[model samples]
Target: MQITFWGAARTVTGSCFLLEHEGHKFLVDCGMFQGNKALKQRNYSDFPFNPAEIDFVLLTHAHIDHSGLLPKLCKHGFKGNIWATEGTVDLCSVMLPDSAHIQESEVEQKNRRLLRAGQPTIEPIYTMEDAAKTLTLFKGIKYHQLVKPAENIEVVFYDAGHILGSSVIQIKYTEAGHEQIVVFSGDLGRYEHYILHDPDNIEKADYLVMESTYGIRFHEEEKSKEDLAKIINDTFKRGGNVIIPAFAVDRCQDIIMHLNSLVEAGLMKQGSIYVDSPLSVKATDIFCDHPEYFDEDTKALAEKYGTCPLKTKNIIFSETTEDSIALNKVKSGAIIISASGMADAGRIKHHLRHNLWRPESTVLFVGYQAEGTLGRRLVNGEKIVRIHGEEIDVKAQIVALDGYSAHGDQTEMLKWLSNIKEKPQNIFLVHGEESAMGQFAEIISQKTGIATLIPEMGESYKLNDLAHFVEKQKLAIDESGDMMELYLDINQQISQMMRAKEWQKLFDIKEFLHKIS
Candidate 1:
């Protein structure tokens, strides 16, 4: 068996990994690239692998950075099945199309600019039509379901506790008459996530691929609710609207839970707070539906409070376009939470467009914002910003609270790795920028006496007998070409995948982007 790191190799966004075993090809994730505009432009580039050649895809969760590129994969040529948990599939139904719309709109705007400048025009990375086709290939698998991934590969999933249906996937593949277990800890969640349950512990594995997003930094604030309460109270006393651009899935619910706790403790005024996303409201319902997935503390909180977090009197769910528009009319001190955490698009943009120029408003950031995103630009103290074709001055105060992050911090990451009694032969750290990966690698090596490899994009490593043959091929292709080929192949494979008979086993695509595999 051989594996190659594609996207999210040296950087955090655009997560994808290729694995080959017994002549079968598969991908762990097909996320979108983010950050600088030059880097995000890679999304418009062709796939490096044959999309149709990838027989299956194991998804981790529905975060845009992890699952945003499925439609492009389908548009290129992939027609295989995408396996994910049921909740992930459901979330994709809402997220993927929204992502597609963003791409379409963005491309159109870019082309218009080029047209005026008399430059060559470009098409959208993928259209809504392509996104629609991609949805036809989804196949839902419940957590802990063990099944064969390929000819001689068995796989199982454990709750990652990152998002509603996020998972940590374990693959047992056979090569050279030996069975090896490879575990992919897809964006491991914290042991004390606010919305979802704690991450599950794995017994053992021959090899492990882990994320190092916060591997270098500690979450400074342990009292997340206390800090949140303080921020809200300070803003409210100044008679300012607390504007938040949050991811509509787990983060939105998590914030609500924290706010509920603050209200219950009488630390925060029970003022009107609006969750203004239909998708978020639906996702909250799913969170309610899956009580079995909750951790002990969350379950007990639900039992003791007699209501889920969002059901409180101060909270309002805005589900209609009219309702969202009407929210602008309320000028008093209100907490308005909207979607697209990065503030790139969605109702959050509209909210920011209206409220950002006001001195009596506070924009609170509770998630990681890619470098080019509006949220990042604002947090970095940009005085002027463009939103929906209007230039607006950022007079509102900006507050960033990283404690609300779902991913485990450096301390939590060490704790998780410390649980392993026996270190594996090799540890490849993926899904983080160079600084983060480098710091974590050094830290892990020092603590565990295990050297970690931070693989570059397009770099490959052989695990069994076929290692020599693949390494020789790796030598034949330039590193840059290999990376391009990986994406090009993905494009070609997914485009032709729809014609295959076993497509159902991989996915039907009707549901959405599923896993973080």
Candidate 2:
């Protein structure tokens, strides 16, 4: 029995893990690679393991970095059930298809460019039909439900609180008449954050596989609301618009909720908050449908302010291209939220192109901006940028609000691990950059006195203890002792025959050698 770290071992994207026991193999989170060209190129690489041989997939959430490659897995002959929470399934129902659309659209545009450059056309990683087919294999499991997916493997999903239906998967596997538990913390969320439940505490685990996305930093979560309100009010006072390039799923909705809170508190000035992505529109509907997952504060607020506390009177959803284009015509007092969060693609690019040249506009980043992305470039104070083949001046105010990060920071994560009643024998860290992983490993080891491993991409480790292999070797040695006498007799007979130069007894010598050789 072993586990392999396929992705998210050294970098903070493409979270995939493969576990094998006896002959059965399963995967947890087959995700797409995102970041620089080198990282994004990994999405096109062949999977190390055979898709057909995989028994099932245990999805952690609906984040594209965690579940985006399901369509590609299905396209490559994976015909297994995909287990997830109800909310995750519903969210993926929209997100996966949207991801496929992006893949096709991007590939088509690339092919056009390739044609002009006299290069070969390339196929998309997957298609809309492929994503549809992948959806058919989904099986939803409620939070805290225990399930036996295989002969020797049992699993339970607990709320991770990072996003809707995200989970910390605890798996119990029986080997050598002994049972051991492995907990995979898919992605942890902020404690007592708006709209979602706190991450559930896991009492015990023999081995823990945790994410370390925010290992080296602390988020400004405590003062996020104050910071947001101040940024909006300041921008409004400057006669500028506040533009937020956010992830459509959680980040966009998070900003929406904050905007609603600001409006209710009368902290933000008069401005129209526009969620300008169709994906965000669909995701918001999904969020509205799953109020059961909301925290007490959110539920009470909803009751006090109608069905959804996320939608304020000034909030507007621009789900159509026409509506998105119309937003460019507005010069000020408009807070436009769009995706992709990294500003590497999507309608957010157009918004940036239009507003970035304006001195009165303010761009607020609410999530992590990876290196080599437009968002990072803007945050790093690039004076000029080219969007859609046109150079544009970067005169807008660029700001990053760290409080909106979904991943819990170092302090919160340490507190989360301290919740385990008994320390795990070994803690394997993944889903973070190398430097962060190193720092986190040291902290975990120093605090808990438990050994921590930072696995590299494509590294595999045996789950069976050293004693088991040692015992097996001893048994094999004892059994081999029975052959020692026969070998001695055969060696003596062969030596005597050879000394006598017994050519006529060659068959007898050969028979003796064959008996024990």
Candidate 3:
């Protein structure tokens, strides 16, 4: 048996781990590649392994970066069951179809631009039919339920507390009288979050895969709530709207909970909080549907409300296109929360187009902004950006609430890692940037005496071999009984170009690479 870093080796998105044993293949988190133009283009690339041969998928969460590719997987002919927590499956029901719509819409938009430019039209990765088909493959299992998906393999799900129904997948496989337990930390959620339960800690694992998105940083918890209220109050006082680009999953509901608290405490004014994304509106309902997944405080609050704790008295749900369009007309004394937390797509783009140019308005970010995303550009203080193909000057205050991140920070991750009764032989860090992973690997080594391993993209390490790793110099293909060499030269060329571009200081490098790649 061996494990390969199929995706999310040194980057923060696109998490997949390929495990092969006894001529059988399985995967954990066959996620979509997100972030930069290069990374997003990888979504259009062929699968590293034949989709038909894969036995099963162990899903960790419903975040697009982690679960977005299921439709494409199904589209490509994978008919295996996808095991996930109940929350994840529920979220995916709406999310996957929404993703398909985005894919079709984006491709259509691109095709229109290409048509005028006399360029070739492109195709979407998958369609609504594909997403609908993918939904059928999902098998919802309760957390902590011992699942025997296949012979010699046992799977269990633990709450990661990252989002509603997010899980840390634990897999135990016995082969040749030897048993190995491997745990995949999908995405660790913060402790004492207002809505979700804390991440569940495991006692032990033979080999571990962990996420390190916040490995090098700690959240600034002090005064964030106060700061949030202050920001909203100040924006409303200035006769402007508070525009928040948030993910529709847990972040949207969490922000609503905060808004509800603010309203209940009389911290916020009697202004409207518009949830402009239908997906968010649906997700909020889903949250209410699964109050069993809520934390103690949230559960109590939910029971008290008898509705959804995610709902606020002053909040409005924008369900229709007309409702969403009407929100753009609200100039002041309103808080508009939209989806595509990165502000790269969905109704958030329209909200930003209208509000980002207004000096009185504020665009607040409450989640991690991946590199090369519009949200990152805004947070990095880009003065002007193009939305809907028009350049808009950014005069609004761009605020990032440091404490609102769903992921746990370094200290929390360490605390969770320390709970293991016995230290694992090796620790493999994935789902983080290269620098963060480096610092975290060093920290783990120094603090716990465990040899931390950082696997590069497409790299593989045999389960029995601790000291050696096989780099993907031969090809970029994942294991499918035998390694295949198809995109080696092209991928190598692209990798070289990316490295060279990184080493050089070029202001137009992003646009240049995007155009060519």
How well is each residue in 425-503 modelled by candidate 1, as lDDT tens digits?
5678998878778888999999887758888777888875322224412312223322433454355557667556557
Candidate 3 lDDT over 332-390, as tens digits, reads 99999999899998899999999999999999998899999999999999999988868
TM-score of every candidate: 0.87, 0.89, 0.91
Error of 1 at 228 (Å): 2.5
Candidate 2 segments exceeding 4 Å error: 221-227, 466-517
Cα TM-score of candidate 1 = 0.87
How far is 37's C-alpha from truth in model 1 (Å)? 0.9
Better of 1 and 3 by TM-score: 3
Task: Give the CA lDDT, 0 to 100, for residue 24 in model 2.
Answer: 88
**Top TM-score model:** 3
For each candidate in the order shown, give its overall lDDT on alpha carbons. 0.80, 0.86, 0.86
Backbone clashes, each candidate = 52, 0, 0
Name the runs in model 3 displaced over 4 angstroms. 222-224, 465-468, 471-517
Candidate 2 lDDT by residue in tens digits, 1-517: 6788888878888999888887989999999888876677677766787899999999999999999999999999999999999999999999999999999998887677656655566678899999999999999999999888888889999999999999999999987899888889999999988789999999888888899999989887446566778888888888888899999888988888888877877888868989998999899899989999999998998898887876666789887899999998888899999999999888999999888988888999989887778888988999998798678999999998888888999988898899988768888899897877898899889988988988878777777652111111110122122233334445666787889988779886568879999
